[model samples]
Target: MSDADAPLSATPRTRLRRMSQKGRGDRGALFEVLRAGLVCHLGALVDGCPMVVPTVYGFDTTHLFLHGSVASRSLTTDAEVCVTVTVVDGLVLARSVFEHGVNYRSAMVYGTPRRVVDAEEKLYGLRLLTEHVAPGQWDYTRAPNGRELAATALLALPLAEASVKTRSGPPDDGVGPDAALGLWAGELPLVATWQQPLTDPALPATVAVPAHVAARAGTRADRS
Candidate 1:
């Protein structure tokens, strides 16, 4: 990968003691981890106090974007922010209660976000955010009008200071005294799938589910 697209030199959750090996140092893996997730928690120090807020995030290969109101006390500032994304793949069922864990992927992105002011990039970023969630809705929906654009706030946080950590399969301690417990030990895999898209209540009676729209609901790891 090119340098800009490379993973962070450090793992994001170095301070979190559990599942440290899941913290990958490569940038590309982290991006893939983030892409697999829809929601993210944004952590930042507002006036030297820590704050954590959950929000929707969209990311391209190079940059991660978040949107909110311009009057947002936390997002509008020039201060640095920490963004984290997670995907729960499955539940690790261990033979013993103490050995249970989750099979998931998570990443934390750190950077001082650049407030997006360029009108073209703002619209483009919005499109990216739209497609990230509802892939085909951008072309079908009307473009943002002036008043709508005026009321929105967007921030671009560089996809840096990130890392990926994943856990899967069975408990790491399946071959000890726990193994003699006679309990069924294995992974209870959790699969995520997008259900069929629900039609808009305001949709015109003549409107039918387009192939582009219908395909989204059945989407899962099969597409990934």
Candidate 2:
């Protein structure tokens, strides 16, 4: 298969033991879930205990890039870690509370992330991160200087082992015995949109919003 059609490598740890049907082995599926999310929860063992930190991330075809303060314990650890990204699409309301569920797309990546030391790669990774969160802001804003780069820590985790899962549509109880209850059963779709840009009060009224930024207002922030 081509790289885009390649399957995700499944190790013992990356295997799904529960809800096996929802597990996706294709690399494209994993990329899709990650692309739709802006944040990821990094799970690692810190000082012999478990710690999960929420942070923004960026990725390319080969790896995921995470950046944070140089002092953060979560990024410093070179041990194996689990990174998760989840995007909730809607709520599945069923006739019975027990049958209620959520519509979501999620991915779990397993690897021992390494700290990026090369200056060129670090800067490139940072650019990818900035552009991922805000499409045009990277070019519009000033690039990080030498001192700013020194204070930041960047980690690169290979996208070799991962899994994706997604659930969507209406309630599952519609055709089951609960259907006799005759209660409401449907999906409440959830959508996230960007609102009007709030300008900095310090900026003079003469400064107008940039076209790239202004165009995003009132648009969907999340991809299905």
Which has the greatest lDDT?
2
Give TM per candidate. Answer: 0.88, 0.97
Compose the digit string of candidate 2's lDDT tens values, residues 96-147.
9998999999999989998998899998899989888788998998989999
Q: Write the per-residue lDDT of candidate 1 for residues 163-191, one digit (tens) a residue.
A: 56777777877778778878898888877
In candidate 1, the residue pairs with backbone N, CA or C atoms under 3 Å apart (3 or more residues apart, or in different chains) clash, namely 7-26, 7-27, 22-165
Candidate 1: where are CA atoms >4 Å away?
A: 1-7, 11-19, 47-49, 221-223
Candidate 1 — worst ten consecutive residues by lDDT sum?
7-16
Q: Candidates' lDDT values, in order?
A: 0.77, 0.90
